[model samples]
Target chain A: GAGVSQTPSNKVTEKGKYVELRCDPISGHTALYWYRQSLGQGPEFLIYFQGTGAADDSGLPNDRFFAVRPEGSVSTLKIQRTERGDSAVYLCASSLNRDTGELFFGEGSRLTVL
Target chain B: AQSVTQLDSQVPVFEEAPVELRCNYSSSVSVYLFWYVQYPNQGLQLLLKYLSGSTLVKGINGFEAEFNKSQTSFHLRKPSVHISDTAEYFCAVSDMSGGGNKLTFGTGTQLKVEL
Candidate 1:
């Protein structure tokens, strides 16, 4: 079975640039989640999608962050005018559903804002 | 809102020695507790969880955690640890409040097993 995967294992960009991160969830999984983890810290929830809609986006730090799950199978997290503070490992996860209680995580996309 | 706290930032133990990574969470309602491990250059992997029914939850790779309601803690413990267990262990709590499946994670405790 294929597990969750994120593209561009690593990304480096300058401040004030726009960036898009992609996530591919497990087969038949209906829920997807995104998180950010800075060095020396645990992952923090950024957003989550249930089916084709975002179930929650409160974890997003500010209006500069937005995410979408158009086909319900894939999700894209977009950041506008990124800053050095946004540099971190962006992680994606999937489960049968949000209530499943177990989450399979992607290897994570390490984003470095130079 | 829910939050988690891990007591130790790093714990170094000898191989075959007992070890415990302490975690405490604060939430207004009942919640689910989980332990995740992150190997170097990798993402977090679920080790164990406690939703209901059992106070002691066993997870993969010979690890377990106990959920304590009165103390507001879900501490991960292993009777004996191996060098292969060296990794960053995170304790998290997820409570679906206001349709938030967001997991509140602790700062993480790095477990180093010395030979």
Candidate 2:
């Protein structure tokens, strides 16, 4: 794709269940980011990956939330023991590099925990 | 550390009227400012950015913003707005100390353009 791509545009699951969201960044982009946006709020940083390694994961809310990019192109966000409060739009973005400061975002995966 | 403040939660404007979305930031070190727009059921799109040199930056869809160092603000403006411009606007800041990668965003401002 010419732009960032995300899977599972909408997901509905019961509380305590697990879920996984996927993101495919633009080709050749070396930096990928994940953010969460709750209702009526702006997107909040979650994690960032530089190539196959996660250079920064401080924005992750808790241990339940984890992300990985094995090949430095495709990334996945895994949530364990999801709660109602975990419902939000998980956004993925990619850039040529962190220094460029210009990120291309995907449509986002809207997760609803019931 | 860096933070952004968008005082107005919502702004209602008539079509063809000028609109201004205010954004302010606080940072201990140098910072990069950005404005992004999110339409219903869509991802955020960059409106403009203030990195260096030019305080006044122009972006797509005839939108522009000015960077005020003293006031620590980057207000988005358009001479005339269209109904299609109605969307949620967000102000974000990134500190230079962090390589300007992670962005801290304000709550947001909903711009409602009516006929």
Best by DockQ: 2
lDDT for position A60 in model 2: 96
List model 1 lDDT by residue over B34-61, tens digit each.
8999998776888998878989999998
Summed backbone clashes in each candidate are 0, 0
Q: Where in model 1 is the C-alpha error above 4 Å?
A: B96-101
Task: Classify candidate 1 by CAPRI docking class.
Answer: medium
| Per-residue lDDT of candidate 1, residues A34-109 (tens digit) | 9999998889998888899988888899999999999999999999999999999999999885774688899999
Per-residue CA lDDT of model 2 for B60-115, tens digit only, reads: 89999999999999999999999999999999999877877688999999999999
- lDDT (10s digit) by residue, model 2, range A3-94: 89999999999999999999999999999999999988888999999999999999999999999999988999999999999999999999
Fnat of every candidate, listed in order:
0.57, 0.57
TM-score of every model?
A: 0.96, 0.97
Q: What docking class should model 2 receive? A: medium
